[model samples]
Target: MRVIEVEHFEAWRAAARELLRDGVPAGDVDFCSPSTQKSLFGDESDDGGRALAAREAAARQRRGGVTVPPDFLKRARMVACHRDEHRWNLLYRVLWRLTTAEPNLLHVAFDDDVRRFDLMAKSVGRDAHKAQAFVRFRRIETEDGEQFVAWHRPDHRILRLVGPFFSRRFKSMRWTILTPDESASWDGAALTYGPGAPASAAPSADDLDEMWRSYYRSIFNPARIKLAMMRREMPVRYWAALPETQIIPEILAEAPARVAAMLKYGASGTRAVSAAEFLPEARDLESLARAAAGCRGCELCERATQTVFGRGPSTARLVLVGEQPGDQEDRHGEPFIGPAGEVLNHALVTAGLARDEVYLTNAVKHFHWEPRGKQRLHKKPPSRAISACRPWLEAEMTAVAPRVLVCLGVTAAQAVLGRDTRALKTRGVPFASEWCERTIITWHPAASLRARTDEERRRIARELAEHLRVAACA
Candidate 1:
């Protein structure tokens, strides 16, 4: 067996990719790490060789083409975050099967390999949650400005995996989160990773500690305390670093008295459901339209004047989904009636398709916009909005039951195809999606309108018409 060892996820990915490219069977390779038996190879798995392997693997990834489902690679990346002794080997075995004999292997939930992979990924996901939840940052004064710092020791090598979360949550501020295995720091502009740090590197207290402790004490509901559940979610290992945990003993001792005092007051938990939950029992196009007008699924509904539903014959076989409504569509409560609509109309004529012969809709019925002077300029909907409005889109698809589904932009494609798909790179190619037999994605008419030059606009318009023609023929 050829010996290969990896210290991290990227290293394993690189080496596994190289091995796969060489058409090496999974059984012919031995994947281990320093904590395991790297020395058993008598220095063959040394630093120099591992470094070279990582470089080559990166080059291969850049060259593209890994045929496993997008979800497989996503899960594999998460699984690699785990420090399990056999994850590397298991990943390679599953990948080999996915590429060769069992292309639909991930669909088999009870299969041993898939189950193990799912379990490992779940553990990594939990570790990621712990890292995101429990790491408490203490404020410190620096020469540049105030910088927040925190220290944590995650159960897995999840520092790299969860760094992006910290960056997004604290985009405007500078902060540093230190762990035993790695450290991540976010300047106001960018996020950077450095070497591991000692717990002593983090400050034990900050000026806001007292306020934070006070707030924690105020919110601590002894009546709702479940020691077992709390310990499981907020593990004891993390308690030493959490300042609020220092007062838990005192709080627990006063539970009975607090419960008695709380009996004098009352709190209740009841909430209204969103408009999607208000779907009529009949579950048809007319009902969906009426229900969507009051959709409180997301904040976008608060501003959009009305929910713009699809327009076409129910018997239409070819359905087109756009990103969202433009200014004109939002005002008129229609799918396509703006400059983009004109472009789509022109493309339809060029491709020999009639507007009434096909269903026209959008991924999001609500228009998300920003103020640009006197006009409401269209903005890309948030991922949360995309997710919130997805059920409505699916309901439309079910009601229409179109034989052919066409996505007109990246956002719409992401909603229809799995969110992780590289929609741009492979536009005009047919995909098999749950909604239809032949799913095709192409340039949005809005994108063509935004082209910088006339030549580019013409080229994109031609491309859009060609894709429409392909969809019609399909």
Candidate 2:
């Protein structure tokens, strides 16, 4: 047996090439680190001399170079970063097979050696990603200036892979990230490496940490808590170094009571008046629309350009409720005048119904959006926002008293029907609502506009027209 000691990936590749050139089979070679001992089987008399001669000849030869698939080299490099001591041997064995036996060995999914290498590489990659996401930097005072320091514990040697990500994100700051196996430091202009460090070398707490924990606690939405998903995304193993984790237990303990309180009172718990409180007790449709213009029942009214109320004949038999107004609709103070409205008008004409024959409004009257550069991008309103605006929608339903109420999307369907009703599952099905005799669920015109392909858009438009035809018949 021939024992080859290699310290790193490049060293292993050089040694493996020499051994392969010398015609030394994998079974006769014992690849290991410099500190490991040789196998009990011992080396042959001429093996060392032959390997030395082959190494010298390879250093002199400049003809054909070692060739392997690009993916194999990538996997080999990632596997080399693993903590497994046998990783070198495994990679060299696979390299030998790729060069001599099977050129396509790495492509075989069921191959034991390929599967092992893939698992090791995947583990190392995952460790790298986790390290990038979970590292928290703390401010520290030093002789030169203030420097940020962070300490992390990763399962693999991934300091090199995750270092660039931190450098790109915090390029203006001087920081050092220390792990048990390695350390990386960025000095504002460049990144430098150092030896490993202990957890005590990092600061335990700082003044900013308390503020960070407070922000974390404030943003924890009790209504949308999903314990399984939270644990899956941010595992408990990484909670030790995160300052926000100090309050996770407290947040979780109070979540149930907070959600109950939100349900008992309003979502914000400050608004006690019903939708009727926002209105001026006017029974006429125009008076109700004017009253809705000054509504502060929800936070959306604060950001919207103006309140978009329903338009069309109040004597119409069909009332259509949409999710909310769009950017153009919010500016123009009308629903169904934007691109989505164009699609709805076309579908209504195709379904043999005139636009003036139906009253049009929305479940939520205001436009909800987040600013993107100079434009306002539409944002989906949360359930609380919908609930706050439901009173206005209920008033519209009471005033119109249409023979057929058509809900255009999930938000509108949930507003008219119960919250548990799903629009996709209830489409084309007529259901009874408290405000109307018959209510039909259908795809919103915006859904057809968002379709991925022409074929999909045509299909959605056809389905929407069919539902509208049913509503027209009613």
Candidate 3:
């Protein structure tokens, strides 16, 4: 066997290329580390000299360079970072197959060699990502200046891959990240790499470590705790380096009592008087809208982009009231301009009424939503939030004083005519309200937009148009 030993990935690649160029079959070669035991069958005393001579000869006889897929190089680089001693041999075997048996060997998804390389690459990539996320720098006072340092342990040789991330993130500060396999230091102007250091060299605690622990404790919502998911994202092995992990047990121990308290009081248990102070004294629509912008009547206002008040003429003959502002309405600072708004517009045209002739507003002025990944999904406002915002809606009604009051959904119906109106049962029937000459109830345009089938959507749209047509003629 032609015994070839290499120290690193680049050296292995150089030696493999020479062997491939000389048409040496993989079975005839013994790929190994430089310090590994020699092959028992044959011992070549001048193996290193013969290998160098072969490489020089192959370089002279190079007609054209060997070629592989572009993605293969990237995959090879990631796999090369793995600490496995057999990686060189595995990669060389794959390279041989790519050149001879199958030109598109990497494309074979189930191929044993391809799967093994993929797993190694994936492991290295995951380790790099976790290292970037979990590394916590602690401030240390030194005679030179205050410097930040962190100690981390990664599963792969990924210091070179993840070093640039820290450099870019802390470009203005001096910091050092030391791992068992490698170490990196940044001095604000330049980054330098050095040999690996022991974990004992890192600081065990910092002055602000307690503050960080407190912040973590404050943000840890016991009600939303998912131990399995937490462990999956932040493995227990990394707990030693993370300062927050020290208090995790304490938090977990108290979680049951905290959760009981939360359940008893509800999420928004704080009771404050209605935000009457934020209301405008002016009886005009524009002034009311401006004042509503600053109102903090309920917790909903804290999260919504802005308060969306009523819009249209102060003397409109018809006034329409719906639930609350949706995601798009919150962003645009206007009511009724989302998918539900589109449905309303189409229904208005079909009912022979122009949208501009009617005043459009929501019973609650602020949007209430919860985040789902990148989206802000609408959540129904609680009864207290609706009650808190009632004064603003009542103010708009009193200012506009439309001939016909159209309640577009259950919340609006309950807000105007009291909860006993039973919006679903009273829809399409005209009634008299003390606030208006005629009051009509109908399904909110959002209800039609959420229909599970096309037929159901059309039916709901027709029902909405009929109710609007009656209110317009009233």
Candidate 4:
């Protein structure tokens, strides 16, 4: 057994090459006696590579003739926690050293970063750049004319672990795994691996690269997107294989513009369907509500228990909009049938408008609520949700074509007015929005029911009746 220590990588490489060529498996070589470059090869012409090559030759000459003793395996673990290129090299050097023998006495000292790296590396294998650089394979032509090749890289090299994965996933195609240190290719049948070629040109796959570039461009989600996180998730080394790497600079440069575009996009409702095509001047509220129940325009249908359709007179001139269905409304499968509806009914009677004469509905045609105890409590919908639900309200408005709309609460006010309505500040004010004409903000009857004081209830109820009167005459 003998050990040869040399500085030049080619020295070790030449030795391994000769042993492999001579049918000597690396494991069979005994390293009981180690040879340093200064001693075994003498001056060695000061070329470390030449010294290693000579030692390998000498070892082969004595292999069957000399009694070789196994070298004791010495083990040491990487202790540094911080991530640095130098630190990475140190870790790999130790790792590769241990691969030559079964490890013994491998000591590990802890660092937070080292611990994190260990955890991450355990499941995913080593950093692809290090550990597996020397992998090479030979190209073989199959009897059926299919070309394929296979080779073994360093045991724990990142490419070796991931290369097979890429091969299996990207099966049915030929690909090259080019590391700076070495390269391997599996055409279809046999695998070829060897020392890395000169860094002349990056191995190219024009078709796949272009497809990857296009996909990256297409799937750049503007909503809730983060650039730094993306870069962290996909490091730069991977970009050499991916087509979109070249376009990343442009994408980052235009990020501000993209963000501005998203903000400008805001919560505008979907493009309006032409009233001329759908309305035809004669569609009734029932047809419209039934049509709205089948809407797939947004995800509101998936979250809400049921679509709470509008219920009221077909020819009513006055329209009322509530925020959404309450618990009772949700259970009953009707709009405005909850305690809020009872309060609204009393206000309607005081205002001299019969419940049967005016059409009542919700801004959102669904009960958006979350479960609490046994009750499904109402949850405020996001701006996007509100925007999504606006179409149904518009459809109802378009069909019923009410002369005046009464926005019963903040959500209703937002849906109709396209802005927040402070109910206390603007309860009696009338304004027009993109969806409706002669729209008035009013205290929702539910507000009256929730009031703690009789005086507060009286104030809200009086305001609600006043708005009803305004709708009746308008």
Best by TM-score: 1
TM-score of each: 0.53, 0.51, 0.51, 0.40
- Candidate 4 per-residue lDDT, tens place, 209-305, comes to 5655664554454444566756654655455444577887887677779767645644455433222233323356766654554443444554554
lDDT of 1 by residue, 1-474 (tens): 998877667677777777787789999998887654332123446777776666775766664566779898888989988888888899999999998789999999999999999999999988997887688899998898788999999988788799987786577778999988778889977877777789999999976677556645654556567788679867999988888888889889988898776455333322222346645576688777766765657667656756788877778999999989988787656788788998999999999998878989998888999999969999999888887788888888989999899999999999878788788887998878888879999999998889999999999999999999999999
- The lDDT of model 2 is 0.82
- Superposition TM-score, candidate 2 onto the true structure: 0.51
- Candidate 3: list runs displaced more than 4 Å: 34-65, 260-474
The per-model lDDT (C-alpha) reads 0.82, 0.82, 0.82, 0.57
Q: What is the Å distance of residue 396 in model 4 from its true position? A: 1.0
Prediction 1 global C-alpha lDDT: 0.82
**Model 3's TM-score against the true structure:** 0.51
Pairs of residues at least 3 apart in sequence or in different chains that clash in candidate 3: none
Candidate 4: residue 416 lDDT (0-100): 75
- Worst-scoring 10-residue span by lDDT in model 3: 36-45
Candidate 4: minimum summed lDDT over ten consecutive residues — where? Answer: 72-81
